[model samples]
Target chain A: MGVNTEPDVLPEARVIAVAGLGLIGGSLARRLAECGRRVIAWNHRPAPYEQARAAGIECVDDVTDLARAVPDVLVLCTPLKAMPDVLAKLAPVLDSRTVLTDVGSVKGQVRDEVKAAGLNDLYVGAHPMAGNEFSGYAASDPSLYDDALWAVTFDECTSYDRLLVVIDMICEGVGDRIIAIDDDTHDQAAALISHMPHVVSTALANELAETPSRNIAQALAAGCWRDMTRVALTDPDRTRAMVEEDAANVAQLLHHMSDRLESMATLLESGDDEALAQVRDFFAVARPYREYKARERGGAAHESVTVRIGGDEASWRDQLLASAKRGEHIMHMTDRTHAIAEIRTALV
Target chain B: MGVNTEPDVLPEARVIAVAGLGLIGGSLARRLAECGRRVIAWNHRPAPYEQARAAGIECVDDVTDLARAVPDVLVLCTPLKAMPDVLAKLAPVLDSRTVLTDVGSVKGQVRDEVKAAGLNDLYVGAHPMAGNEFSGYAASDPSLYDDALWAVTFDECTSYDRLLVVIDMICEGVGDRIIAIDDDTHDQAAALISHMPHVVSTALANELAETPSRNIAQALAAGCWRDMTRVALTDPDRTRAMVEEDAANVAQLLHHMSDRLESMATLLESGDDEALAQVRDFFAVARPYREYKARERGGAAHESVTVRIGGDEASWRDQLLASAKRGEHIMHMTDRTHAIAEIRTALV
Candidate 1:
């Protein structure tokens, strides 16, 4: 099952079937189609199915119909909980050549399920670290994954070349930066970066909700509170679905975070003259780490080009889209004033 | 001494002496000067004094000189730890006619010190809920406190009318929204909105710093982490000084936050069938609270008007300042493409 180490071979343009046309799936499908790859989408829910169809995407209504389409690459973009069941249903139709992948938050569980279903050779677990507070098919954009980190996990026995062929196509199509790690490593990193942070944000939000003077406190809420709790605005059901798949990792990180908070409280409560100094030291160490992170993240492989334009509000918006299409990676457009607009483009 | 407050009587425009020309002090001084009020600034540090002097603000080198000026309103803008000593040194010269106030995060300590000095009637504790990550006199802007929340705490025996007169004067001068809370209430709110969150952010940053994959994680860090840890980038000395004054409240809130995190971790680790549902419910309650806060904040008394202009980058910046002066409350200007600019002004 080991992949052949062929550097120059690109995979053929076989039909790519995307299961679950939510934000990730819809965006991937749109991006792949835009890149001249044949993309067919499947959605269990009629709303997203209709959305995909309305967006000019070819939609397969049934699992059998999707399996019959015989896609060379099958991407499972369903929620974490739904992936196992979806995999079970699709397993019967998958062949050795049909490389299977997924865009789930936690990869360990999905990897285990794929192994249990005897599809390890065909599976490569992937998670693209790209999304917003908004979700679903309607919010999907073709460039959602542009310049974003995409973590892919491969087992030792997996066909690395074959998996890379598929991944490289998707990455190239969507302009994603590839980050290869094992399933366990990927899940651990996800806990650190995504899952634990979500829990922390929710806890902060919950505490604020329980405050008696929440109304007054809310009036006093500034940039710090807003930034700390922005992720708490996500759909509750979706967040639950995501967190549950990686519960143990999330819980472990939360426990560690709790310990950290307790230590800070203890230092503050010590009443020693040096207590403030200790607190100062704690933050002093953390400051550089955060600054380093910010600096490193900013230095990622993304080149931004700013373009200036002038127009009315509607015209500015229209010009923004036009510039985005022409540039192919416009990240955002700021309306400087009524007459001036700045379009920031991230070159692929 | 009770301040004689007659309904038709306005306090005479006496000199305003602002001590410690840091970010808050410098901005207040600039705003006061811009509002046609004579402002004299004092800074213990030579650099800030020089900066204030360079900014065309009147600076008093000595505390007695400031007192000799006989300011009707004296605003102490030093750090929390330095406030008591600064107040003690200036208490002898501050007569009953001069209404004394200090802008400090923790109001209880300042309130106690003022009472200890028998200057209760002449003292009001204030905490302006405004600042940027950038600090010092150099970062000060005349509009720093525009549309910002300013918490003012008055003791029970204080002359309410006189305090209100001084507060109204200061608030109007700085363009801050008045949120009158008691010492304890203000501290508690400050802990919830500012201090505890800083600890949480530092803890999170510390955890990342301790990770072996920190360098990689830093590379992969995105918006959520960026927002959550932004305040962690501030000067540790300043943060410690602020937190130490409000240590008890901050510690208590941090303990509460620890408990919340512990509970969330417990729920995640329980392996209950309803765990996902419970998590969903937890977040659902919090989402609306945060949304309400954001909506209310947005609805604060500020009307932003956008004006369009076209020019080169340097000329656009100049035009932005010119428009801001003409508009009187330009909150921000965006550089829309190279040709056009948008200036957003908040109407007074």
Candidate 2:
């Protein structure tokens, strides 16, 4: 097999190594390779080895091979629970010149682990706010991070210029927009936006599980329940691990959500016209705020055309992207169900 | 100047009078007209009168005119709060031959009102499970009730044959499927399937309204939050009226939801691995059940193509339906946002 050497088209002379070839790592490696960089990938499992080799990416059989490659940048893409063990094992192999970053959802725990391993000076935290229902190396796509927001948390002791260079390199390689914030702030924001929503969704689904008329109700469920509970379809083990790690934050947010739900229940139960009016006013404020936020986020601006194609969505997305002109892109694609797939594309 | 008389093409020699020319009333009138039936509509408001008249449906100025024109059937399409008053007003004018029905979401209250108005023998409760985000006469379409589920509840004292004939006429006029249910069961099912979901959606939107990072979170919100909160964009007064009328059922459901949410919070807070695994198992059951229900509902079977056409969605939907082939239909059409309208059509 032909090994992927560093290409001349790359502006900087930097070797990149990606550990744990899951969706994120695999996608990163694919994007970096496409950007004319030498990318070496390592995975504990053997399933991704053939695919990585077939993609012309060098596969390291052992963690020591990662240090032997002498990569200037090392990206850890392991699951949250596996991170500490992986970090500890690889700490001996990492050199001072190797700048480390991760694509974990939570930043605080990773930051603590890096500090505990005496690698704070070489570590920066990153979370690409991009994912789909599917996971693993087989589902990896080069354009997964295109135009996605990447949250980066930097340590005070780390060299600012060196970290910035590495961030810029990754951003350029994957076409991701950077959002710099502190680790705590990142966790707080993520709890509200991501983890909290997941808990709400899962809990809602669980509620439905116990309802007597759930089957009938599900038959009649419109867009609301479908959207609200979409995240419940994710891998239970993976989600369980994430929620366990961020249990404190998730629990706090769930408590807040419970308070809000209780308030609504109390208002409805009050049987007072004024309380009903108050509830109405509450929704009146909510309606415009939600709409405004949706509009502000460019959710309402797309001129999209959705068509049903019965096959692999990624393949169809790739086919469309290849032939699409400037300003044309897939706005959204639904998970395949009943041998049918829906793809919404925004036409310029 | 013209009055709608009996049309010969209709199988039954019946005149259908529809009171309240809002979305449901106007659409019913229009569809009845299209089905070669004489439809006379009466609206308390002046705005819809001209529109109804323009659509070739005769408009009545008063309740007496509706009684005079409605020799066979009188359908009450007024709001929940106005229903008792309207029924009392029209009760003085109606004869025993007239079959009375309504398009109300809550059936128990309407049944009570019908009984109080001494029209129980002539009344049959009907609630069509079809609606759009928009309302009023201007948003009405002839195909609004086509292939939609129409829940019909009957009182024990009512004339079965007469009510069935009227129900058949209405079903034939609008091409709706009949779902026979008791009034109380109808209310309970509707609360779970429709009203409760609406409340959940509104509360979620209210949560977003109170969030400090709402704008940022909304920017990152994927299909989950968007779908879950879509109903929050509806008219607040109409929703408030419904919620108030069905406050008891809604409050009970909300209390149940709160309990479920609290249980989840307690589990997560407990930080017990077994508890977390139980929560995960909860989701495992929920996810498959939801998917199975969605699949059983034919949610995954649609072969729809959505195109962005910037204009009035109702007008576009009407035009498409008017020219569509025997099996084709408009599955859905989204409201115009940022000057872009999306219409999804199913090619049979």
Backbone collisions counted per model: 17, 0
Give per-residue lDDT, candidate 2, residue A266.
91
Q: Rate the local accuracy (lDDT) of all candidates.
A: 0.68, 0.66
Model 2 clashing residue pairs (backbone):
none
lDDT by residue (B267-313, candidate 2, tens digit) is 88886778867777756767655555455466455444443323343
Q: How does model 1 score on DockQ?
A: 0.24
User: Which 10 residues in a row give candidate 1 chain A its minimum summed lDDT?
Assistant: A338-347
| Candidate 2 CA-lDDT value | 0.66
DockQ of each: 0.24, 0.20
Model 2 is docked with a DockQ of 0.20
Candidate 1 lDDT by residue in tens digits, A1-348: 113333334454356789988888888888888777777888888687766666566887776566677777778888777767887888787766667888877888988888877788788777777776667888899878776666666666655445555555555556555445567666776778777888788888888778766655665678888888888876656667677788898899899999988988999899686876777678766755755545546774444455453433334433433443332232222323111112222211
